[model samples]
Target: MSLDYDLVIIGNSLEASYAAVKAAKLRARVALVLGETETNTYTEIDRSTFNCLTYLDKKGQNLTQWELNYDFVTHLNSSQIQTWITQVKQDIKEYYSPAILADLGIDIIGESGEFCRLPALGFVIKNRTLRSRNYLLAMGSISSIPKIEGLSELGYLTLETLDLENLPYDLIILSQTPIGIELAQSLNHLGKKVTLVVEDSNILPQEDAEAVQLIQAQLEAEGIKLLVNCPITQVRKIEDKKWIQAGNEALETDEIILITKPTPNIKGLNLEGVKVEVQPQQIIVNDKLQTTNPKIYACGSIIGGYSLSNLAKYEANIVIKNAIFYSIFQVNYHPLPFHIFTHPILSRVGLTETQARQSYGDDIIIIKQNYKTLAKAQILDETTGFCKIITRRNGIILGGHIIGNNSDELINFIALSIKNNIKIQQFSQLFPSYYTISEILFQISENWQYQKLQENKFLNNWLETLLFWRRRWKL
Candidate 1:
């Protein structure tokens, strides 16, 4: 069969739309299959709303310091919040409108479709068959629902379907994921009593334990109830009130939210016919981002890791190249940084301390600097966390975990060092401006140098002898 296009991207996800636009820009004949359902749009909007609300709430406390006499109320009425949501939705729609995409030479298919295998592999939607040299699966993710008895009957809220404008007074959120924690914090700040239930021993199990503990502490300090290592056994609705049997405690709340790891939306696409292997949570792909069927490639939330659009776009870049041309390029996530957008953001890149120890043994070095020590942090009155840099004994930066104001920005410096194979010692040579948060990097590098000096007894003795000789000669 003659190919209909060079690439056929399946799904209406932001990642899919982005790939389509990029492929078109590359001058490849691209067709975007936007199914009836909308994916990731609402989730993105909710995330943006969370960030905006958090920023306003934090800034409200410093109104007097800024010499502003206005009282800042971060809370918005239901209709006002809905209006904001509508405007955001409209803006996103305009940005990715089919008409705009068509101008770039992309075929926009609005109907839902499934993969067909018998009559030469192609996607079938109504009367049309979208045949291409390569297929890209960019289907977005859906919230993973647990198998708790009575929970399905109770019908909990997911991030995509959450009604922030009409949030309940009390919430029992069942999740340990970063998005879950972010939502819990945002809702708590909005005057909602949030009880965050984590099935794991700690939140963000992949992150540094100390940093995770600090975030937990911050949440608790803000009156958010946190239940670690506690799993919900059952949930039942009782006369407009919901009761949850979590671990040993039976907690009552007005609503329950499930914010577990997201599952990819691959149903009805007939991936089995196309020989695509899929786990319960993600689609299986190789380093080249190719599915089991080499002709098919997948990216974004479907392949699974974190539902970060920037990471997804990075993957899309690699996928587009290999799909349109020879499959030589592979996706690299080592340099990319991810962060939870909570107050005193928890951002990280590269390996954690445990991973470094597992890989390099005890020969590695760990350097920590408190945010409170930074003049910028003190001046900003936002010194609630610290930065931990994990490095090899030779000072090669392996990873960085930070929990503090602008941690999202600070982590990038470490990410760049790791990406470029730059040593931690080089950070000391950098001259950051006075009273800046970036000084933490210099302090951490110096701390590493000081640690090495302390550990080197021979060097210490040499310094002591030189000092004594110089004193005796009065030089």
Candidate 2:
């Protein structure tokens, strides 16, 4: 077509960067319009350096990649869970440099540019009259402000605002998502009176129900008031008081914060010439990340489905393969692992119990194990959670959910197992040691048999008591 440029990447986010790098490799003349600096911008770090742990392996030697991967999968699984982590780390190390684009003759534009549609070209934008051949829109989502009546009048802060670090507020009301919960908990831990409002019945509702219960208990224990099933009806300001009404009851909070929703940034793009469609807050794309305009593609939070940074990066790679290499590979969303980084984090992949039941009927079996009985969780002194495995009647592991200290890292094991069709019997056969949380999988896998043996209650109690005594005596 011989257009102005090969590809124009609209955002400098993780997904956008990935797409840009892939496009560059295809020898596409690329341009990046970045709103912020690229170095370490999206990475999360622990600010409490004093509490961070530096561990030494049993050999008292440095750990190798194989060691880390072996230990990780030994505790978890070897499927996409490991692949996703490895790819992200590899991508960051190999292609994360901002200067790489410039070195490849890709132009970097600092200011924000809006998209426009012209008669000849299906989609286009003007960077002071310089148009591009293909447009890759990745502006990301904007924070959603609840229609609180007085919120705007009293002033508020969002993730974007809080990211600035200058717009100070005394108190912040947050939602239950990672951004909301993490910020609220962090500020509260730093002496801010933050109240987390969850319209859903529980925090991290998408997580395992048991995980959600454990996290809710932990958050409540931390003195964070969790208002469940109470939607913020109105936010109004009276004099200096910021009043928030949930249903009929009114409460006053100092500041209001809205978490971002999955909304496409195509408002002024003028897509009249293109056949792409957007509903409510997102763009419609097929499994291949292809838009209605066959020649165009989309990825990241703009698509409204799975919006994790890792998922977006995967989608970006898919787009690159399809667009540049003309490969027929499609995006597979099965066994997508996501983590909620609350205090006792929650992580899940595949179907929940509710989902499995609806999809596979009541013949589904759920295996569960407690963390208190696990040696590692007990040793870590964080035994408030458990792992639940959902399987079909024939013993296919459908999903895995974990809610506890290392659930974020551990859920991948279940994800890998499910993705690879690893059966419950195989998992049980591994026979992980007693003290590790991974043992929970083995414990649950054998739970059906244990339940049958529980017919003799007294004998079971006697056996449990004997085991407890033996462990206690050993200690």
Candidate 3:
């Protein structure tokens, strides 16, 4: 059967546009179907607001705690940010102009898309019907609004549709992700009474116990009320405020914000018409980013497992190889570090301790080192969390978890170590520069050896074996 385009991407997600570029680069006839009707909300924030600028005091280490009057929020102009986002969106569209893409043997579709099978396996977007050999579904996801009894009827705040100018006196944040927790604390620091509600037993359901415990402590210390393992039974308006019935407790709040997991955006695509298998929450995709149907491929929110834009782009490349080139490129989800951008960030690489125990049994070695022990942390007065590294009984590193000032960046080294099959004993030699957050990695690695020496001769035995082999590398 003849096809209109070689590759067709549906949806306006950044990943969708990026996949179009990748496909065009690979010398394929690409067509992107997107709705330019609505403003792109994801990139609405100014780039400068994201760049971290730290204020240093005497001796050049102590962080200056500045908010309202001196923080980045003080400089945020809603109108300017919106303008920038609009400009960026236009830039993306123009950069991949039809004329430019035509030179690369690609086409374009600017409308809503749906799959049809009657005439042929194709996408019908408004007036134009496009037939493609393969389809890359980079359609992003929507906010997972839980099935609260009266939530739909009585309106609530979502991260996407939040109004910053209209501040509520007391806010109830129903959340399940780290972004929710970060917002809770951040809004609290902004002088709002905030209560965070988590359906799970603890904050960060997927994080290590130690990281969770530390973050939970810090959240409480920051005066953010946590209602853990508690979900709303009913929501209704009580004159000026909103009343919530949550697990035998009644609470009243000025407004409610939902920060839940992202539900896949596969609606109206008529996926069932094409025999594509989709879960209630997400579309089922294999490691290679291929859907249940060989001709259909997916990434981004539809595939689930990730919420970050970068992860979606990574998945998009995998789909390009598997769907376009007929090559196998799998995602190593584990050893993929994640960070919650809270004041004291929470980050983890590889498996959680619970996950490690489940996979390797109870024989896995565990070592924990606190940022409080580091002079750099003391100098900065940012000693609120610790780093925990897990390894095998024979000295192979398994996983790492960090919750501290620089936990976000610190987790990367641990992730690389796990990815490269580097062991804990070898980490001590991987020293970072003096008086830095990275030194914690080297200290923890040295501590791992000490712990092993006290508990077992695991480190010594590995060293003896290395000496016996006399294996030396010329680096």
Candidates' C-alpha lDDT: 0.86, 0.65, 0.74
Can you list the residue pairs that collide in candidate 1?
A: none
The residue pairs that clash in candidate 2, if any, are 76-413, 77-413, 143-260, 148-235, 149-235, 150-235, 150-236, 375-435, 376-435
lDDT of 1 by residue, 32-149 (tens): 9998866653465567666765667656756655767776534455456567767877788688898999999999888899999877889999998888999999988888788998
Model 2, residue 457: displacement in angstroms? 20
Per-residue alpha-carbon lDDT of model 2 for 15-49, expressed as tens digits? 78778877887888777777443322223322111
Candidate scoring better on TM-score of 1 and 3 = 1
What is the lDDT, from 0 to 100, of the residue 201 in candidate 3? 84
Highest TM-score model number? 1
Q: What is the C-alpha RMSD of each candidate to the true structure, in Å?
A: 2.4, 10.4, 5.8
The TM-score of candidate 2 is: 0.75
Q: Between the candidate structures 2 and 3, which one is better when assessed by lDDT?
A: 3
TM-scores, one per candidate: 0.93, 0.75, 0.84
* lDDT for model 1: 0.86
Superposed Cα deviation of residue 170, candidate 2 (Å): 5.9
**Model 3, which residues run further than 4 Å from truth?**
39-106, 455-475
